[model samples]
Target chain A: MGQFFVFIKKEFYHIFRDRWTMIILLILPVIMLTLFGFAITTEVKNTKLGVFDPSKDIATRSIIQRLQANEYFILKKFISNPDRIEDEFQRGEVGLIIVFPEKFYENLLHTGEGQIQLITDGSDPNNAITLTNYATNIVASYQQELNKTAVIPYQIVPEIKLLYNPRLKGAYNFVPGIMGMILMLICAMMTSVAIAREKEKGTMELLLVSPMKPLVVILSKVVPYFFVSIINLATILLLSVYVLEVPVTGSLFWLIIISLIYIFLSLALGILISSLVNSQVVALLISGAVLMMPVLLLSGMIFPVESMPYLLQLLSNAVPARWFIMAIKKLMIKGLDVTSIYKELIILGSMAFFFIVVSLKTFKNRL
Target chain B: MQVIEAENLTKRFGKFTAVDSISFDVKEGEIFGFLGANGAGKTTAMRMLCGLIKPTSGQGIVAGYDIKKQSENVKANIGYMSQRFSIYEDLKVWENLRLFAGIYGIPNRKINDRIDELLKRLGFESEKDTLVKSLPLGWKQKLAFLVAIVHEPKVVFLDEPTGGVDPASRRQFWELIYEATDRGITVFVTTHYMEEAEYCNRVSIMVDGRIEAMDSPRNLKNKFEAESMDEVFHKLARKSTRTGD
Candidate 1:
């Protein structure tokens, strides 16, 4: 035990003495948090809006008032001629335009026929889709208000209700993903590189010839990286709560317990990688290409797994981060208790067990 | 008493025989030189003695512990210094010493005093806190040798410990080796430098994964009809069928 402590102290000295490693360990989490929180966002607000309403009737005016009153749009200008709509879009001053035909109110009241057009910049497809959806919802709501006084037969309206993230904030989605990514970054990548460094420098041979057990050497190497990962976890959670306004409404204790399990799995993976490779550059390449790439692309961090190809979705099931991110989303955003996340807990727990067993076996076998 | 005993110790990697049925013994407190050219199986044999690798087929004992069955005990009772710099370059002088001593299971109270004595003896009291990377290569090599034996093991294996040192530093390194032998510590060292072999009490020359000749340097010179250990080594190494590793 004393030997273990001494080895851990040496590991810390290695980390603290190197400026680049210190920066990566302590500051990179904050940078990733802010980058995901504020910089990369899907929620668009305060979009400049253009209008071409020739009738200027009370009904058209009410819809215009509703769009302006909401937070998504700003009334930039009213184009006079329909022919100039193309020129208005070419100016690029506004992202969306609304045009109501002449005699809109008269058509709706007397003949029960009205047409309103919503045009958006399709170059940015995601933004265009969101804007179109918001406009359609507002128009549907206005029609519903009209239908309350006069019943219209054979008119079907679909109701779409979002459950957990009602406002569709990107923070709610990415906070869990950032936790998965940063934990893997610190625990797996750093630990592997650190162990491989000893081998590369010939220090591992010295260590092997000593009285210390192989287990002690490996445990000591990972302990410091594990603590750093915990600090990163706290940084991510704190930033998500205070800065991004994403809260942990479920049991904090269970959330932490699950995160610790995932951390253990990552550490085991690091040991496995270090055992297979004898140099730091190879360790870094494997961790970056094999570990980080899967965590980023296939773990459902940036894309939905269900929408992917069948083979890819099957491959994602093997990624430990997918289970961790799923459980985190449940606990943080949906505010689900532990019972609701039993599937995720079981999957992550088994993966941790499997990785630890395989890594230990390979560690002993390789030497 | 023999500190290391090997009977037909052999290691094979697939079809390649790295160390083939080599047998040897070394008495306590003697500087036993392991001489070989590149890929002459010098490292492979040293690794087996230090309990770092498993022998394919052999009977061996290191520090009274069976190399195969009690490798942990063998490891505890032995010290090893490799051709490469084994100490952590980023760590301070004292930190490297303390780390190795602690790993060897030296009592906590004895480590500081031992470190102090080492630093003082090496005239490094003022540089205890200095990072090892900044030290001169010779000083680093000397420090590595000291750190390896901090626990006072029965046997110390040095694999080309003075590989790249200047002649003066190499001379001082041999003085340290003499000092270690005076303390009754058996030294097993490998070197490419022929003059360094003359300093060893006994020298063994390996050719083609086998020891061709082993005797006192004076005896080896008389038997081979050569004036220097270099001529004696070349006489045996010329029979090697294998190329450099």
Candidate 2:
């Protein structure tokens, strides 16, 4: 244990003395969290919408009012001629256009039905779909209000509620996910690279040939990183809670416990990677390509595993981050207890055990 | 008693043998040199003796520990310096000394005094607090050697420990090795420079994984009928390649 402490002190020196590594370890998490929090969002707001209202009727005006009130669309301009609608959309200024024919109200009064055209720029297919859906629902709601006073026997009523995030705050959803990704990247990749660096410099041979046991050496290398990762975790958590005003509905203790578990798994994975590869570059490539990418993609951080293809879903089972994200979301967002996420806990425990065992085996084999 | 003894020791990576069947013995407190060119199996044999690597088929005893069953025990009793300067670059000179001493389970109170003594002896007292990466290559090499022997192991294995340093630094390094031998610690070293071989009490020349010649430097020169160890090394190298072909 004393030897381990001394070794860990050296590892700390390695991290703190090097300017480049210090910058990477301390600055990267903040930059990544802020960039991902602001840039990547699921909610659509302030989309430019164009109107081609030839009807000049009260009912059509009411539908436009309802669309504007929802905050999903910003009224860019009104085009008198239909020909200019295509050009505005092509210029990328307009995301959607609402067109009502000249006799819209008259037709609705006589035949109880009117045609309203929704011309959307399909270039950004996701936003286009969302804008069209929003416009359709507003028009349906306006018609229902009209039908209440009118003698229309058949009416379609639209009721919409934005659940879970009524204000559509992007930070609330992304901050937790970014926490998991950044922690995993910092903890796993950094530790593995550090170990591989010692090997590359031939320092590891000196350590092994000393009186230090192999387990002590491995533990010492990982212990400093474990503490560094915890500091990063605390930084991210404080940023999300105080700076972003994101809620942690569950117990703070549980969140920390889970994060520590994931950190250990990542560190073990790094040690395993360092054992297999002899160079820092190869270790980085393996950590990023084999570990980080899968965590980012399949961990349900960006893509939901339930909606993914069957093979990808099956492959995601191998990624520890998937389970971590699930547990974090449940704890931070849903306020679930440890008992509520026992299965996720089990998966994390098993993965941590598996990685540690594999790393130890590989270390023994190499020595 | 023999500090190191090997018989028919061989190491094979798949079908390619890195160290062929060779036998040798080193008495306690002797400065034994394992000399060869690159890929001459000098490092392979040293690694086997230090217990960093296992021999595929062979028998050896290091520090009275069986090479087959007590490899870890052998490691515990030996100090090894690889070809590269293996000291931690980001650590201070004293910190590096403290870490190795700690690894050998040296008492904390003893470590401080020992580190101070070593820094003074190595003439690094002025730069003891500077990070090792800031030190010159020669200084780093000397510091690594000092750290390797700080624990006072039974034997120290130096693998090309003087490869890139200047001749003055190399001479200073040999002085340190002799100083350690004077304290009754055996020195098992490998080197490519034939001049350094002269400092060894006994030298073994390896060619293609097998020792072609083993003797004192004077005896080796006389047997090859050469005026210097360099000419003797050339004659043996040329003779071995011709036979291999």
Candidate 3:
């Protein structure tokens, strides 16, 4: 036990003594959280819209006013010529265009319906779809309000409810996902590279020849990283709550327990990687390519797993980050209990055991 | 007791045999020099004895532990200084010493005292607080050697411990090795310098994964009919390469 503490103390010194690694470990989580929180949004806002209203009437003006009233779109220009709409969208100055046809009020009075064309740039199809949907809802609501007084036997009412994310806040969705990715990268990737560095530098042989048992040496190397990863977890949670205003709906204790479990699994994975690879560069490349990329892409962090292709969905099931993201979402968004996440917990546990066993076996075989 | 005893020990990595069926014994409290050029099997044989690598087929006992079955025990009773100065460059000199000492389970007070003695003896007392990266290459090499033997293991393996040091520093380093051996610790060292082998009580010369010659420096010189150990080494190396074809 005394030897173990000594080894752990040395590991901490190695981590803290390097200014670059220390700075990166301390600052990266905060930077990524802030960037992803503010920049990634499911609810599109301040989108540029061009208006081509040829009918200069009161009703047409009222319809344009309703579109401008919504915060989702910012009215960029009112072009008299319809030909200018294509130029505005082509220059990327406008994401959406609203055209009110000639004699729009007269047609509405006579036919009880007016034609409005919504043209949106579909280069980024997801954003375009969102903007179009927002525009349609706003127009439908305005038409409904205008027709409220008329006694119509037939009416179409639209009911909408947001699933998964009710409030449609960007931070609420990204904070938990970023938390999982950052923890995994820090605990697994960093620790693996650090251990592989010892091997590359030929220090591992020196350490193995010492009286300390191999298990103790490995545990000591991982414990400091575990604590550092937890600190990052806390920092992200704090930033989410205070800076981004994302609420922690679940029990804080449960969140901590699950996050810690994931961190341990990541660290074990790092040790396993270190045992397999001989150089730090190889270890970093392997971890980033094999672990980090999949976590970011397939863990439902940036893209929904269900929305992905069939092959990707099947691939994501094998990624530990997917389970971590699911577990975190349940804890942070749904406020679920331990019992609710038993299946994810079991998978993470099995992965942790597998990595630990493989790493120990590799270590023994190398010796 | 023999610190190391190998009986026809061999190690093969795939089709390449790193350490062929070679046998030798290292007596207790003796400085055994393992001499070879680049690509020689000195490192592989040393690794097998240090329990860092397993032999493909053979029998050996290192520090009273079976080389095949009780490798962990063998590792516990030995110290290894690799060809590279493997000390942590980010750590201070004292921190490096304390870390190795702690890993060996030395008591804190004893570790402190031992570190103080070692620093003073090596004339590094003033640089104890400095990071190892700031130290000169020769100082780092010497410090690595000191740390390897700090736990006072029964046998210490030095793999090219003086590879890049200047003559004066090499002399100083050998002095420390001699001092450790005088304390009844066995020293198993490998070197490319033939002169360094002359200082060993017994020396083994390896070529193409086998020891072509093993004896004292004077005896090897007489057998090869050479004036110096260097001549003896060159003659054997050339003869082995000629026969290798």
Candidate 4:
């Protein structure tokens, strides 16, 4: 244990004394957190809106007021002529336009039905579709208020509630994915490059000839990365909660425990990679180009797994980040307990065990 | 006391043999030079004896431990230096000393003093805090040798320890090797420079994965009817099927 601590201290020296490594370890997490927090979103906010209310009646004004009061849209200018509505949208000044018909309030009072035109820029189909949904919901709420006392045919009513993320803020999803990605970056990539560096420098031969056991040497190399990964986890968590307003509704202790397990698995993968490759460049490339892309695409960070093709869904199972992200989402977003995530934890545990076994076997074969 | 004894030590990779049935013995407090042209199996034989790899078929004892069965024991009792500078270049001189000392099971209270004594004796006191990478190649090689034998092992194996060093630094490195042998640590070193073979008490020449000649320099010179080890090596190495040097 004393020797192991000494090795760990040297590993830390390697990390701290190098300026490039220190920058990557310290600054990369903040950059990735801010980037993912801001970029990863599909929900529209503060969209530019224009309205051409030709009727200008009480009901049409009331519906427009509801849309403007919400955080989804900022009412730009009112267009007097209908022709100018398209001109404004074409100028990129407005993402959506609300046009109330000439008899909007009269039709609502006498016939109990009205027409409201929702014209939107269709350059981005996704943005257009989401904006349309927002406009439709606002108009529907206004109609419900108008029909509070009116008797009509019996209708089936449905009530909906979102469980984990009530606000559906993108940061809630991104925070967990960031935790998975940053931990992999720090633990797996750093450790593999470190070990491969020793091999490339011929220091691994000196280590092999020493009295230090190979297992102890590998463990010592991983210790500093494991601690650094925890620091990154804390960084992402604090930033998400305090700055981004994404709260951790679950037990903080359980969240840390799961993250620690994930860090260990990543470190094991690093050891396995270092054992297989001899050059630091190869190690860096494999860990970055090979491991990182799968983590990014298949981990359900940017894309949902269920919506993917069936083949891709099966391929996602091979990505350790997929399970880690899933488990973290349940704990941080769903506020679930440890027992609730036994399946994900089991998969991560097995993967860690497999990597460790393969790494040890490779070391033994070399010996 | 023979510190290293090997007979019929062989290593094969698939169908090709890298080290073919080589044999040698070195006594305590001796400088045994391992001389070979490139691809002549000097490194392969040394690696087997150092317990870095298993020999295909051999009977060997290193520091009173079997090379095959008690390879771990052999490892514990031997120090190894490679052609490349093996010390941690990113670490300071004293920190590298502390790391090797700690791993070799040296006591904590003695580590600082040991490092201080090493620096003082080697006339490198001013470089205690300098990073190893900042030092010249010659200094790094010397430090690697010092670190390898930090535990005072029974024997030290050096693989081309002075490959790219200048003549002045090479002279200083040889002095350090002599100092180590005077303290009764067996020295097993491999070198490409035939002139270095003259400094060893006994030298062996390897050609085509086998030892073509093993004897004192003078005897080897007399047997080959050559004046220097370089000429002797040229005569024997000319018979090689691989390289007709």
Q: Is candidate 3 or candidate 4 better by lDDT?
A: 4
lDDT of 1 by residue, A1-367 (tens): 8899999999999999999899889999899989988889888888899999999999899999999988989999999988988888799888899999999999888777678899998989989988887777777777778778886622344655557886678888899998999899899999999999999999998988888888889999999999999899898999899999999988798899999999999999999999999999999999999899999999999999989999999999999999999999999888889998899999999999999999989988877
Model 2 spans > 4 angstroms off: A52-71, A81-83, A99-118, A133-155, A167-169, A250-254, A334-343, B7-21, B55-59, B208-210, B239-245
lDDT of 2 by residue, B167-223 (tens): 999999999889889888899998878899899999998988899999999999999
Query: How does model 1 score by TM-score?
Result: 0.95
What is the iRMS for every candidate structure? 0.7, 1.3, 1.6, 1.1
Best by DockQ: 1
For model 1, give the RMSD to the true fold.
Answer: 2.2
Q: Candidate 2 chain B, which ten residues in sequence have the lowest lDDT sum?
A: B236-245
DockQ of each candidate, alpha-carbon based: 0.84, 0.69, 0.64, 0.81
Tell me the spans in candidate 1 whose CA falls farther than 4 Å from its real position.
A105-114, A138-159
Candidate 3: deviation at residue B59, Å? Answer: 4.8
Residue B139 in model 2: shift from native, Å? 1.5
Indicate the residue-level lDDT of A198 in model 2.
85
Q: What's the TM-score, to 2 decimals, of chain B in model 1? A: 0.98
CA deviation > 4 Å runs, candidate 4: A147-166, B243-245
Ranking by lDDT: 1, 4, 3, 2
Per-residue lDDT for A1-367 in model 4, tens only? Answer: 8889999999999999999899889899999888778775767899988999888899889988999998999998788999788789778899899998898788767765677789997889978977887788777777667667668712222223346764457788888888888899888899999999999988888888887898899889988888888788888898988998887877788788778888888888888889889999999999998789889999999889999999999999999999999988888888878887889888988888888788778866765
Model 2 agreement with the true structure over A74-97: per-residue lDDT tens digits: 888888889887798778888888
Model 3, B133-178: lDDT tens digits are 9999999999998888788899999999998789998998999899
lDDT of 3 by residue, A20-77 (tens): 7887788989889988888756778888888988888987888778888888878899
